[model samples]
Target: MHFEVPKVRMHSLREFAQHYFMIVLSILTALGLEQWIEHTHHRHAAEQASEQIEVELRGTLDSIHGALANNARQVAPLRTLKEAISDDVRRGLPDAQINQHIRELKNDFVLSVSWPSFATQSWDVAVANQSATWIDIDRLHKYATAYAAQRDASNWVTHDSTIALNGPRMVDLRTRINLGKDVDPVEFLGILQQMINTSTETSGHLEQTAKPIERALAEATN
Candidate 1:
């Protein structure tokens, strides 16, 4: 008896093609889903960061404005006391009263002057101590410069206003205090106040803008 060899069965061409098509479609779908998930996650993270920045910026602005107002108030009492003492001294008032007033004025002046410097120092510390990324640093620097310019201008106005108020009538006192023609204290103080206001505003804006950038950076990094 002769045995016939069995023929091997093969897959039809259509079935082979269908199998490969399904595999390709599955892989593409998986990749698409992964991309969508990643995009959504990044967007959420960015929004969170932006919100945080906005809140922080507002707080910073409030702190700065409060400092400025404090500085402005402090200057007034010290200035008035100084003027009184100086006027008494010029009019040949009793040595005891003059001396006492002078002492008190000196103390007040010292305290009043200390605040503006302190406010500036605080700002410096806050900005300088930040350990943000380079982009953040750059953004901060720009914000700071603009703020500083505004502060400087405001300070000038305040000084000028003060000087204008005290300069004309108190000739002997002005001379004693070395109040030059250019030294208008009121204007200077006004200018200083304006500077503070401007700086506060600018800082607010910067603080607001920073949030978005931070979010963007976070997303990019993620």
Candidate 2:
């Protein structure tokens, strides 16, 4: 069996062009609106991310301040330890009274010395999602610089902690006290001096690094 072809109507060139123009215009308009919506959503997300990051940085600053104060409190004890050790070396272990001093050093200084770490979740999220790019370049640069300083401070803290945790001095102190054995005062004094210097420098640098970050966060929030 043969099938008959159906009759079809064809458009004039002018009608076809007019239809084509409308279709293209509609597509372009839809694309423009979609792009605008996406842009607005991204900007809003970025602003939220900035605000959260600022709050987080403020918290980080507070942590740094607490750590600084804690470190500062160790200074006197460290000096006393140095002096006591020196006296022991020059003369002899002072007396039972010195045991009180030793206990104080252990309680106040050794146990108290610690490293501070901050949570950067907001910052990490913003950066990971590329929302940080929405912030002005200057402000972004400021944030980056502050974080860089924090990274340096963290490195110093890690170095100081390594010395504290792994040094022979800590072992010697523990052994001397627990066993009531005599430590080589001269060797102990040298180690104590190095620790004092490390703690002082690390605390100072951390404060300096954190202060600028705090100020920047304040400005950003404002």
TM of each candidate vs. truth: 0.43, 0.69
Model 1, 60-167: lDDT tens per residue?
Answer: 445545555666665666556546755675687666665455444444432332122212443443445442222245444544553454465456545642442333
Worst 10 residues of 2 by lDDT: 1-10
Top candidate on TM-score is 2
Alpha-carbon lDDT, every model: 0.46, 0.71
Candidate 2 lDDT over residue span 55-153, tens digit each: 888888888888888888867687777776567556765555455455545543353454567777888898999999888787788777777788877
Q: Give the runs in model 1 whose Cα sits over 4 Å from its true position.
A: 1-10, 85-107, 110-222
Shift in Å, residue 103, candidate 2: 8.5
How many steric overlaps does candidate 2 have? 0
